[model samples]
Target chain A: MAVDDAVRTALEREVGVEHEELLGEISATLTRRYAAAVGDSDPLYHDAAYAKSLGYANVVAPANFLPGVICWSEGAPYDRLREDGTEADTHLPGVPAKGVRVMGGGEEMHFTRPVVAGTVVSRRTVLLDVTPRDSKQGLMLVARYQDEYVDERGQELLRSVRTVLLR
Target chain B: MTTPSDLRVGSALAAQTNDTSITQVFRYSAATWNTHRIHYDKEYALKEGYPDVLVQSHLHGAFLTKYCTDWAGRAARLTDLSLRVRRFAVAGETLSIAGTVRAVRAGEERRALVDLDLVETRGSDGETCVEASATVEVPRSWIGEGVLP
Candidate 1:
């Protein structure tokens, strides 16, 4: 079977199935580094004292910080990764571990609560659907994944439906 | 200090220019643990038909989020953000982002919900890289005259 067909079939079958992962805690360093990398100098993200002044126990992460992280674990061995450097074991189910080029298409996010440093996070994801369209480059498969990120206590932090384009 | 009184449907937040460098791209990739070669390996990027390393889509999200949060400051909270990547941005490019108020609606507890339309344009060709929208929840006091109508 063509690799593309296999991906499409797998994606279709995987739709509606929920996949969950424990994304670990939101650390002060992770939040700080992410904020710094974005060149954001918001004191609420930098100073614990300032955050406390605002009633937070610790620095507050930028709203999209949790989903912005591509990998929470150490990741797969180099040889086990795709040519594009993405892990074969990514949260994205159905898509082959290799032989596919994947890129983020877009994202829609709703922030339910402010995430402060030290909050443990987990995410539940499910494939929503897939559409095949001819692109200038070639055939492209567009997939959207619904994700709900929750705090350790099961309270929701944010929800997003992100689109990924694959070839 | 922009307060709630400054928001209006036709008003636009100040447009700001963000300059990205190769170093910045590398650092952002490292900070996010993104191992994509298209963002760091210039050779790989060239092979992929891009001139140089490309910017991460989430980085674009960060830029748009920053624009809204900076404008809202302490008076408002960013409740929702959505973005669609229209084009790819290469490293060392200057990106200009501008947001205009789209609508105003009443919120719970004497609050107001402000919707903003945003666009990120490339400085080199003036091409759009991403288009986004955001909703902010603000105290009713932030509403400007005619902003509700």
Candidate 2:
């Protein structure tokens, strides 16, 4: 898609729509797998007793494991993949910004509390905002998505603001 | 509840480097469901004001985590993590993330809280592309645990 067309489509589209993502319960296996992938051997993330001593009833999730918490609800995989064969959402299926490459500019994470094992989480997402930057190359688009994580009782566990830079 | 105090300020920690490749960035984008084109499409990235497919912000943060943990060693838990992307990270750029101890505290129990000034620099330019700060929990006996010994 042309860069201008893509930009217009994103701007005209509804932004800031609230989405309730049922992330289901925390899984020890997933945590262990992530820890292993990251080459982490922290006992608090693997041993229940160690975690309990730290005031956690079960294993704690890794700081970057937020992607595993939600099943991003959106379109098919193939359609969302960019021309270079990379998916759009990074973790879940979502709208395709074919011409644009989204760079995870970084995130501001507020861990209100620890996510213990077996507690189901609900991630609420809001599109937040989209700003366009006209650079020397052409046009740059900044997309920000805000994800709020809550428990069964509606207590905020974590809030993440993810910003991505696209063309 | 342990606050942000109790950590030694002005101390130093070891720095770490990661030889990041386009393939790794592609896989990260795939696994994370990130579909931003600047990450893998060099043509697109160039057209959008970058030299190549830029690294994701979270990936940069991940590099910071590696730098801290490499120095803190095992038995460390990131009690709090906060990062702001100051610039872009392009592909084929080898980034070395390093940190200096900012503060330390007596965290929840047997945990020493630490804060650091995190930085990511490109080998080619020798300039820090991203600057961040994070709070992590390390065991009080971390140095004696053969991690820093």
Candidate 3:
């Protein structure tokens, strides 16, 4: 399935429109689990005392922790899932819930501050742009989404621009 | 660990290797709440043209993230990272990450910002699977003057 006119129109309409979600508080356990999953044994990410010794309030999250997480809340029901097993209600804004295939192309991230346990976080996402390209498989649309993560006090934590390819 | 003062352009960081397994892939998917069948269901992956359950894209990012942070240690902070996946590696493939200092510049509060060009290549075919770059904030005291080459 190639990117058709409707998909292009939908994506174009979402450009610059911000979608907000509360990602909730960061937890030390979750951070540790994420680090363990990545096979990283960095003490700063696992030991609170070690983290504090290094001047952090608590164990710090890995650089890509925020963006690496796919869903923040309990995911949608089975019916709300796309054929590719992605939740239809979040992430990609204007893209249709069905028919289109989505793949992660790449991302550029700026980690402004270390995320520590007990810090409530929120994310504001905006569709940056969409470009049409031809691929061997067929027509592909490269859509870029920019996500800004902040603590409850509105202090920036991390900012990322992620590219998704739609076919 | 390579301190900032000792980090001259073209200096290579120690290489880190990760031997990925199907179980590791499954655990990563569970931890991230990712239900994408291509990461766990070999049959589904085969239908999608992959030989076996494929590694998640974020997992690749995770490995690269670990590489940078592990090298930077506790004091140095990883400020920026960018990654592009050029190829696919299935579960059970050995992935090796290595980096070289590209540039060094001054930063706030007596810190030096080091830029590194990084690459993650698969062991089986020796093809580059992911290309990346990172910026780390390290203490200026650690970076000696005239380090840039």
Query: DockQ for each of the predicted structures, in order?
Result: 0.87, 0.29, 0.77
Q: Which stretches of candidate 1 lie over 4 Å from their true place?
A: A1-3
Q: Return the interface RMSD of model 1.
A: 0.6
What is the DockQ score of candidate 1, to 2 decimals? Answer: 0.87
| TM-score on alpha carbons, each prediction | 0.97, 0.69, 0.95
How many clashing pairs per prediction, in order?
Answer: 2, 23, 4
Residue A71 deviation, candidate 2, in Å?
5.3
- TM-score for predicted model 1 compared with the true structure: 0.97
Model 3 ranges with Cα > 4 A deviation? B1-5
TM-score of chain B of 2: 0.83
lDDT of 1 by residue, B4-58 (tens): 4667787888897889989989988999999989999999999889999999999
Candidate 2 CAPRI classification by DockQ: acceptable
Better of 2 and 3 by lDDT: 3
Q: What is the per-residue lDDT of model 2 for residues A1-167, given as tens digits with 9 covering 90 to 100?
A: 53575565655374767777687777787666555544457686689888888778789866666643223344347875666555555432134646644455667776676677777888877777777789655777777777888888898888877775665
| Residue B7 lDDT, candidate 3, scale 0-100 | 72
Q: Which candidate ranks first by TM-score, i.e. highest?
A: 1
lDDT tens digits, residue span A86-160, model 1 = 888977888888888889999999999999999999999999999998887777899999999999999999999
Better structure of 1 and 3 per TM-score:
1
Q: Judging by lDDT against the true structure, name the best candidate.
A: 1
lDDT of 3 by residue, B1-149 (tens): 45444777788998989999998998888878887778888887887778998778888888988888878876788889999988889999999999998988888877888899999999999999999999988887766567623
